[model samples]
Target: MIIMKAKIILILGIILSTALSSCVSIMTRTETDVHTISERDTIFSYEQKNAPGNQDMGIVYPSSRTFKSERRLYQRDSIVERKYPDFIRLGVFESVGLIGTVSGESSYGTGMFGIFPDFINLKSDYSGDSGKLFSGGIYRIGVGEWRLRWFRDAANWTIGTSMIEFLIPSAKKQNTLSSIFPLYIRKRYYLREEIPYIALVPSLGIGWYPSQYVNLSGSIDIGSLGGLNLRAYAGFAAGLNSQEAYQVRMSNESDKSHTSVFPYFGLGISFLDFVNIVPETYKEWKDHEHSSWNIGLIQASLIAAGADSSAVAQNSETKLFTGFIFKIANASVALPILNNQLYLGTSLANFVVLGFGEWGIGILPFRVGYWQTIIADELSTEPFIEYNYYPSNFLHIGNRVNLRISDFLNLGLVMGFASGETSMGIGSDITSQYGAPISFSRAYFGISVGVSDRIFFPDELRYNR
Candidate 1:
């Protein structure tokens, strides 16, 4: 046992040392074109003309040592508006929120449902004691209305078509594809200027075909307008003649066409700025320095935790997990002490242990954290259904030291701490009267890669010019 413990300590020390020592330099060398101008080409110059009487009056001048000759270059600032291709207008949105089956058939499974997206499971078993309230997350892809140019200067209304909408619900055994090819209209009220930092948006969607549904919601968006932003919303959704509703009706042998009404409230991220329709006059000088709104769009990590020698010897093994952090929006903050910024987003993680795997979503407070050039720290709270155990809430605290490879990519070393509950028995058997439970605290270490904005380096504002 002593030798085994020593090995574990040594291994951990080596991992930490390697991670800390792998920092990458953020400096880049660039070539500049030098222009030579002759004295005759000088745009403007002046020479002192000694006045006839003053020249003989013994007027004195400063020593020649104080005078210096220098070459100067001046570049005029120009405003440029980015134009998008007519056919390439696209948008991606993701949201997480609480859903309640307000008015639906109690005997029928009224949870969220979807189609397409192979990862979604169709059949659902709602027999468990789960209540009417559950959590859900959605992913949407939309096209059209690029920047609402048709609205002219108003540009406050957007009419688009969603190509796909996928829904994942908690308390349900399977995932579902909600709709495809739905017409949506959104109206926004700006609280400030053209690039307003805050706006109220109300939207409606109507779906037809495979499943019929109506979604109505109102949301408040914060952060950079038209680009990456954070969204909070409350709305009502109803499925009439949806496939899942029909299944519930058929299973119950009832003539009534089942319908489900879900009232939900949640937060999400919107990446509508990808269409880049903001006018040049509304853009700030720094806006021209970056082509994208976020530092990173997507991040993935491979992690391992809970390495107990006794557990490994017993064949339980250490837990291996894969995590993904999706960027919703980010903004630079003005602070006195440190280089700081706020990140608003969500994360999804899959944990595998002893051949069993489970998925967890971190929504709500989303991901709120600070990131400097090379280091980042974040906190998240999520509900996880662990392998061989019931659903439990877990708190995660994580840190990362990033090594930037380029303006578009970064690799990082990650260390995290998780606090939750672990079952002492096998499977759901831990819930039995004879089962035992214990507190769970594990340290996870791994590596992550991000498709992000320029990180781990000084801003390359000169390159943009």
Candidate 2:
């Protein structure tokens, strides 16, 4: 029990630290006003050339200077035109690549996925009830999207799906929140000339939670909001619900959902910049070549933990147990928000104490993070830090260096502090018969091996690019 408490505290700390530190925004937009200025200058020059009575007006046209300026402008325009094909290639291909994505949205007034029943006809229509409107009700849906762009980045079609799980009050009141499989397709159009870049998105999809419900939604994405894309969406949903869906999941609840046209509105923040990438050239697109894929494969570690042992019923000083740890998979992903050099990943590993006849596995995905590349090439090195939580009530912090052997594999040497209850069963001669709670801390070393990049799509085989 003591070790379990420690594990909870450690997990909470990790959550708080990540949430606080990850808010720093690093995106800076580049200026594209050069083309606008060039257009205005060209128009002004044409007007001057066509001015009335210019022949008699003795307008001393500096022919040599004018010719040079015109030549330079023409060359600049030609260069820009030459890059248009590259820009088209980039927009059509970049989003098609599998890349890290994170987004969130909330709908108010309308419930996209039955967030709140529009009219609860339980005791009668409660649609106008102010209490229901401000009940702190929420339905959160998150999805990872696979998007395809076409026609010179002018349009994109996205297909995405996400599992539905309730949180907070929703979970406590509902006995079962199951079969929530949401699939959606959204279309986006970039408005390039807008001062504050904007995207018009119209989406349609279905939420299949035992039954099918149609969802129609639309949002306007404002590209510049403190380096984050701000999305405002409002939509309505048409679906059927059982009587159980109407009952408010609350301590003292009286509600029923009997409405099909549930209206919703919410705001979201995304790492996706649908508008800005529309103007990117092929060379600029190469920077994102490595962004989509992640390091894949499992990492196994031969570990030892300190614990009391005895050949008979007598106790002995602490010593290391020849245990083994095996994680199913390990992968490094580019952090989508920062879109910088930093990367984050996770490992799912299990541990077995051979001497104690005890075993433990990670309860959640163990974080394997910190991949700021200090060096790149055939011989690559990056800093690595890992935080792991075990079902046996063990919490570990592993700090190490990662060396990339090739494009598909990496190796690391790790040494970190481990603290928690010993997973020693009572049957073991060393452990107490009652399975007394055992606690210990030790510094341990482990080696990590895994695949480097798990490609999602070919770099070149994207839409006719």
Candidate 3:
């Protein structure tokens, strides 16, 4: 009853959240392009006089726009109309991003810690033995997780740690143990207008829980198959315990011990940047270098040209972005070849590219495909197809019914197939993680959050003329 009630509550919460999401708009206002203006002399003169020099501070400009233009290279203080739409949107993601940063950095140092004794007991129902045996040992498995992520520009660097315990059942007794991961690091780079991003992780460290041992591990996350994150970690460990605590000696059996090569897997919100992490130093510098006069120049020029500043701000153009999506996801992988055992996985989709015409490749190192909207209106249907290869090889094809919950979020149901096998999942393919094909599984349900000025413009903003 409790579980059912909890599930009901969860469903209700999702409904409420989705309803609220529909009301939230991803407001966007384009930066005024002087090139669009018939008169360029005013802008040129302002640039000439206010350009920064080695000795002259001149007039200041918003540093946020420093990298806003590719053509304005080498011009850090380029002044243009402050894009009002960009800042008009409520700082929704900024707050969430800050929360992630804080939780990630402090989890390792302030989380739970303890030491306990472990016991192994044999079951009495064994057919091979009528007697029960028991053994005891001391062990420590730090149960906690921490991830510190840096999301700036189009790059992300995430460092994290997780402690997981494993249980081994033998003929005589059952033993419990856990692995201590001191460090895990990943670097992600985004490709504009593409869906496949790139990610790399390197590992180096030593662990001393079970015994004095050196550890080395690494893996790449492939993020194309949908709203799941997947990764593999393998390394060699010296002085590790043998798989079998006791083995009977046979005529052909040798007493030699083999080095341990361990493979670890993880699934969950792998690696993503819900919001950009603005550095304090950069923020301070930008704040100190503010130039109110440039803003005045822009407003005066517009007014002189018979334009209203408020109108210019409100009439800003909309920007369409086509770029590679970088994402982190919650996911899992089944190691069928190993032991048919399921392992949790953390993944980074480094190169999920979304280009013009809504084309891209993603779901990681295993899949490549295309997505298209069949119908777009008050309601929309998008169908996507991709080829997947990994634990299983197959083709995935599916579609989604998307209803605007708000400008920044979507609620939908997505279902599809792989070759003859079937797989289903729900999510919008906007962020690098959620808006891809669901691979390796058969079914899923999801929600997607993103940025948009509004889902449906107010009647005043829509002009039939």
**Candidates' lDDT values, in order?**
0.43, 0.40, 0.28
Model 3, span 269-326: residue lDDT tens: 2322121222311232113221000000000001111111121133344322222222
Best by TM-score: 1
For each candidate, give its TM-score against the true structure: 0.50, 0.38, 0.28
Which digits, one per residue and each the tens of the lDDT, describe model 2 over residues 283-372?
343343333224343444555544344211224354443444555334444444443334565543344332333333442344544444
lDDT of 3 at 271: 24
For residues 377-398, could you state the per-residue lDDT of candidate 1 as single tens digits?
A: 2222112122212233455667
lDDT accuracy of residue 456 in candidate 3: 23
- The worst-scoring run of ten residues by lDDT in candidate 1 lies at 113-122
Task: Give me the overall lDDT of model 3.
Answer: 0.28
TM-score of 2: 0.38
User: How far out, in Å, is residue 349 in model 2?
Assistant: 11
